[model samples]
Target chain A: MMNKPFENAIDAHGPTVLRVCRAVLGMTPDADDAWSETFLAALRAWPDLPDDTNVEAWLVRVAQRKTVDVIRARSRQPVPVDELPTSIAGTDGIPHEADPDLWSAVASLPERQRLAVAYHYVGGLPHKETAALIGGTTEAVRRAAADGITRLRTTYGASAAQEGTR
Target chain B: MMDTNNTPEFDLASALTVGADEMDSLRSELARRAADDNLLDVTYRTIDTPLGQLLLAATERGLVRVAYEREEFDRVLDTIAQRVSARILRTPARLDDVARELDEYFTGRRTTFDLALDHSLSSGFRAEVQRSLPSIAYGHTASYGEIAALVGRPRAVRAVGTACATNPLPIVVPCHRVVRSDGSYGGYVGGVDAKTKLLTMEGAA
Candidate 1:
């Protein structure tokens, strides 16, 4: 079993994991932090990963855990002010410049629904794998994702559609 | 972007899309951090030369592999991951010195490469042949028979040629300095044309 260069793994799945992290965390900096931490952890364990592993699913699982760590740390610490704005300059959802309505809608989602939607829909993992990451039966995760999408339609979809037309 | 099922809403995934530039910056930061945290096992980068883009890969020990573009860089990387560790990245910091030295060598500002070389890819008779190649000097040429004799295997001239062909590190290891006994360029790992170009640049051809 030939192992692929970890760079290939990053190139293939970096965007997917970043999207998953951003949706789950709802803040650019924390999401970036989670993204970096997830890949770093993956790199550390990359050699030991079985060659038969689904790298995207594995990375999403890692990102899921790393994002939880960031969330926990966020609650324990004072909110950090942006110190190096230029470094993270091109990021979306940069607070004032972000779509407040969309951000609020996502923030308003129940944690389970948000995670299920992110892991399954955003991360492109199957509901079974998403359920494995977030802990529930696959059927329950499918329902949660469906419910989350419905909630977003009412809360965020209207404004986004109106903005698109205007 | 509305869902295609006659749903009157934006696509959820597109709604959460991260910009391509944003993802690039994030990946760049991770590459740097992976180096800092010492998780980058095989760092690689490419530099353009007269021979075209040359791929350089390094372990923490030193420069591990140098390959020409014709070698198919992706395939070379896969081979490195299999032979070395799979914990590899395209971080260039580790190979900065190697690339700089190569640049200097190509421009005729440097004669000898002052880079640490990892010889993990070669062993036995092949290792002996490669180990003696640098001693052939900058503008000097040696025949396969001469290299065989130098390595104490005068009867192993063909083996010397094989070593040069399979050399993991090429110009840096000075394998091109080994020529045919008839004073002609033999087969080279970077193709015969690259070998001729290097020899002409060194004023040996």
Candidate 2:
């Protein structure tokens, strides 16, 4: 099998993986880490991958694994408020309207819902492939994506309308 | 909500947008990681000259291939990737010195190439032909018949012509210095116009 050069794989799938990561990981340093790690790992294992493989789907799978690792690693750490004085940033009863951002809205979702929405909405994967990546049936992922989008429209989508395409 | 046929209601899809800056940084990081892990076996970039853009490639050994713009650089790179190694990158810094030297050559500031070369593309009689080219002098021309005899195969002038035709390092190896016995500018790997250009620059035209 004639292997396509790995650089072509990067060009084709890098942005899609980045979008999926930003959705699931919320545009933080963690998102950048997930993007870099996915490509790095792909380069190392690239020669062995089947030539006819769906490269974007392969990269998204790696990004999903890396994103979950970052989240798990972050969750294991103590909350920042636990270490700081209570008087600092508002950690408790934070106002409903303070940070009405898409990132926070996405962050508020359960992990599976966030990933399902990200894979389908941003990565533009079909519900079947998104379900396969997330270890759920297509019907479950479909409902999760709809639920996630509905919540975003109610919360962040209002700001999007007010702000108009920033 | 820009609802149209097969469109979703919420415009939150744009929120997941990734910028070109992010992609650039990611690509550079991938190049760096590939180099550090010893996976990037080939690096290539293109240089612009009075003739046109020239594609330059290098392996860990030295400069490997230099192609004219007319050669369809994408196909050249693909062939190199298949023949040499699939670990290819279009990183310009890897060819910075070579490009600088080429700039000097075209501008008439330098004549000799102070760089390493990979002659894997030519071997046996052909490699001997390439190795024989430098002695033709910087501003002198030699006939293919002359080169054929120099490589000790006096009857192999056609082989000498083939060697010049397939020279992987054209300018550096000075393949343009070899011409027809009648002193006409001969076919160049970069085409006849490029040969005339190089020879004219060298004071041989």
Top model by DockQ, which number?
1
Supply fnat for every model shown.
0.68, 0.36
Model 2, position A67, has a per-residue lDDT of 87
Cα-based lDDT at residue B77, candidate 2: 75
Show where candidate 2 strays beyond 4 Å: A76-110, A149-166, B1-5, B8-17
> A58-117, model 2: which lDDT tens digit per residue?
788889899889878887988741221111122233332223366667777876778788
| Per-model tally of clashing residue pairs | 0, 0
Q: What is the lDDT of residue A114 in candidate 2?
A: 80
Span of 10 residues, lowest total lDDT, candidate 2 chain B: B1-10
Clashing pairs in 2: none
Give the alpha-carbon lDDT of every model.
0.83, 0.77
Top TM-score model: 1
